[model samples]
Target: MVADDSKMWRTILKDLLSSEGYDVITAEDGLQAYFKIYESCVDVLISDVIMPGLNGYQLCRILKKDPHLKDMPVILLTGSADSVDRFWSMYSGADAYIEKTSSNALDNVKKILKNFKWKSDMPPQDGKNVFGAVLDELLAETTLRAEISELSNHVEDVDYTIQKIRNLLRSLFGIKAFAALMITMSEMILYSSLKDMKKTEEDLLSRLKRPYFPSYHTYRTIDGKEDVEGLNSIYKVISYDGKEEGVLALWRERSFSVREEKLLSIICEEIGGIFKNIIEVNEYRKNAYLDDLTGIANFRAIEGHLEKLWNSGKNFEISIIDIDHFKKVNDSYGHEVGNEVLAGLGKMLREFGEKHDVFVGRFGGEEFMAISEKSNFLTSVMNEFRQMVEKAHFSQSMPTLSISVSAGVARRDDFSSYTEVIEFADGLLYQAKKEGRNKVISYESIG
Candidate 1:
């Protein structure tokens, strides 16, 4: 029987356990659960804590004292992330504690049920030494994986590092499921050189679009042959608190063994928190390289984007645009209104970039930039924006006040690098401002 205040979770648990051939029962809360299971012959109890009336802990405590239900084997399902809850569950006389958000919740339930049945239903000397070895192996693997997980906390590029760890574990444990590997961090594909992966990347990407995935889900290919290809691939989602950070996919020609499934499930749990930390670190690094004011990507970001494009052999143009008489506006209208003008200009440039297929960023104060691939289109668009800013009103204080921008454009060349292209545009921009404001200067116009 499963008891919880959350009807959705209750349904989900009911479906999962019922699918495993167990006759399942669900209750809305602990109060309803007690009335149904009290003096009832139940083999196992699955309940959520923090429910109305008697909570799971209280229910477990009461049941433990009852002569008939004392050995029923209560399992407390909780959303708690802290280690303290395990102690509390044990104190309440619960046999097992399962976290609600656990990726392998159903699997954990099966393992718990198996152990309970093994101890209670089976007499001593039945399974004997073999059962003892199975239990010992499970415990040993759990403890070792926990230690490795703690060590992975220090890793930055978790996706890449985990490939090595997976290999090590495969060799150490003599694991058979090894075909191809694909690792991703929040839809950012880190490494995907998997066999038969030309279209597999698309498949893996589609999986990430889902709001959630079971910690371990199998994707079997049914290319109707003579026989069934069971569990051709495994997609392991690494997440924390319902937010996902990464996924590790493993492909194999043969079906997975039962032992490998258990091993991979434990590994997924261990790596989820580590990948979460890795993603957090990457976000922090990216944020540090962005401009605080004007919402412009910093020079470093621009360079990175350019480098990627250049490596891909794509044609692109770089332009530097500067607002005319910006310092005067700041001096006259105070920095506040000047800030409003800069913000307005950034928004305008961003819209134009989006509409015209350009990459826009604030190069610095009083200066902004746009990168585009269209040679004939972007130059005209930048010139048009210069004209628009000149005619548009910024504020009531400056109703009749005019704002103008001078731009210098440069196209990708065989001779010049991305930075060199920017420098060339910067020189032409100097020429535009020096000669006259509110004019667009092409590099062809200068030298």
Candidate 2:
């Protein structure tokens, strides 16, 4: 029996298995498949994990508990790459778990079927003993537990992090709103519940910014403002690596009891590590796509951006800019000064890209690239940037020093592929250098 929600997968699997000399029966969903399995003399069942009415796990669990069908081979298949699905399939007593996305899916299914010894003596069982209400409740509880367990492993999105934390706390305190203030080495970030609390935020920031003992505290205050007067608050200073770095605060109209305060303290004790992990993960992700020295998008990021635009069939232009006589600058001055020059140029190009509605990145050492939707004045835009680099001072110590850039611009129509466009632009850049340094070369200029 082949059970899948997608008609294409159902047709394909049925045709393949039928060609392999096994009689194939198809159902659009797990519920229909469950009824059909009881009526037909099925040797093995192949079920897709995600289906309407009943999922693969739910169906497998029901079959495994029945006296007659307990020995039947059940193969669970899914297109999902998440590891949690494998765990769930095993927990639900599936005979074998297979990913539909795998190249050897049919081979794996055939292998499992070949090794199975069918218990032909036991007849098919009826659905009279199956309790739908009990099964539904069990599945609901199991799913909720799985989602809560997954929270610790998944922390890629900021909004998801906050929402999950809120959900975790909602049962404990009937949580309405909360706020967090994180202080990293580079910047400070603040998050608050969607409820309007501008005045409350101001008060908390002013009061909590000072140094505090690394512990949770509860306070009841009667400030002049009516909103502030009736509230009770609890806040904890989160410390890691022997230094205070952040704070988490919650407040409500009713005063917090002693038991709730202790629970809050226990929960707050572990939050420091969570916030630290979030900050470190965010930093690592940011550094992965940005150039270390120049703070611009790196080559890998640039390539991804260009590929995305190209795949979308957008009309755009690519501009390649190279610093003239950059090797001489490194030889005359130390690499430290050369780095300063590169950093300054990167910053200037970033600002220029933002102002001109272009995307710019550091292609490599002494070379930067810009991408923009094709415009009639594309050549003039490149010249404007070239002139900016010519006029800018790279270092305050040597105000009289001059720096210039040579550029090449190519439109999307000039080449068949994005890589070819970049190569053509690079050739124009070489032509500019061959004719004279610090020149803007393009198809328009050469033509």
Candidate 3:
């Protein structure tokens, strides 16, 4: 019986074996193969490792436990050139293991059949059932542990998620190194523990170009033996939202055991959800720092920047701006029109700040703030901004109604604390309003 999910592989193997004067029975999956094995007087079973319902290992374990079928030679075939697959096949009580990609796959299978035929007269093996039972028990324990780890894990960002995954892989497999390559619509990010990211990326991309296996979770291999810390990497493509999103690669000196491979599959299945949650968390964080009314930085975000700049002892200039007679505008027009006016002014200020390499945000009510590195042209920049506001029209519906602003500027060098500078700028703003509205006030004017 030849069991494989792929129709092409089943047909090719069945024809090849039938030509060797052996009647061939084909099954599409492990479950179907098991039932067919019972229905037919099968002498040999050739099955692909990765199949739906029941995998090759599970099928072999079941066959080895049955006294009637335990003596029948079973050959496990896999697309992965990973030596671990051969170990897993033998542990599952298969008589022989063959790589489908091998040039000698046909010769190897024929030789195994010839050898097993000679030993057909011998009695059935006695210890295979015991070993198979032990393998199943070990796999169950590993699966339970992986499930508990997944349930308890909570990650806030992509970096944290990757780190947690790395730690888990290391603990589970004693991996030498681990890496990830994530491709989004806007960017491609690569992270590796080995530090040689350029070389790792080059080798990973090259190996990914190799032929893919025909299994539910296909793994491709480049060579038969372990290469270095990173060259002999085994990677699984992460897919979500109906497309390939990333690659997770792992390297270890020792080959992964059968139980570890199963656990790795479970990890691959859940990683897509982890990445999706991280993206959502980032979007939530970004929105939290943005102003809803102005669609710019909120006061909380501004405070964070101020704290950073003050702690670093960097010299920067701050401008506190207020709209002249803003209450009158709100009284004459409704609050809706006042909101539109605020939003329009915010858009203008944000664009101007961006053009001048300044940081701007809405302070509160009808007030706005701007911060910039201390420069020789600071006073001129403030004057130019005031003049622009005086000449500009804010409301398109009420274009004839003009708006003007008053600003007070202060430098970080003159203040003991950032709060004091804000208070001093607010006082200067009051001074500008006291003398007359629609003017810019600074330390130089008061001095």
Question: Against the true structure, whose lDDT is highest?
Answer: 2
Note the clash tally of each candidate.
Answer: 0, 0, 0
Q: Give lDDT: candidate 2, residue 175.
A: 52
As for lDDT, the candidate ahead, 1 or 2, is: 2
Q: Quote the positional error of residue 435 for candidate 1 in Å.
A: 2.5
Question: What is the per-residue lDDT of model 2 for residues 5-56, given as tens digits with 9 covering 90 to 100?
Answer: 9999899889888888888998898888877777775778899999998999
Error of 1 at 383 (Å): 0.8
> How many pairs in model 3 have backbone atoms within 3 A of each other, for residues 3 or more apart or on separate chains, i.e. clashes?
0
- TM-scores for candidates 1 onward, in order: 0.44, 0.50, 0.46
lDDT of each: 0.69, 0.76, 0.75
Off by over 4 Å in 1: 1-286, 395-400, 444-447
lDDT at 80 for candidate 3? 92
Question: How would you order the candidates by TM-score, starting with the best?
Answer: 2, 3, 1
* Best candidate, TM-score: 2
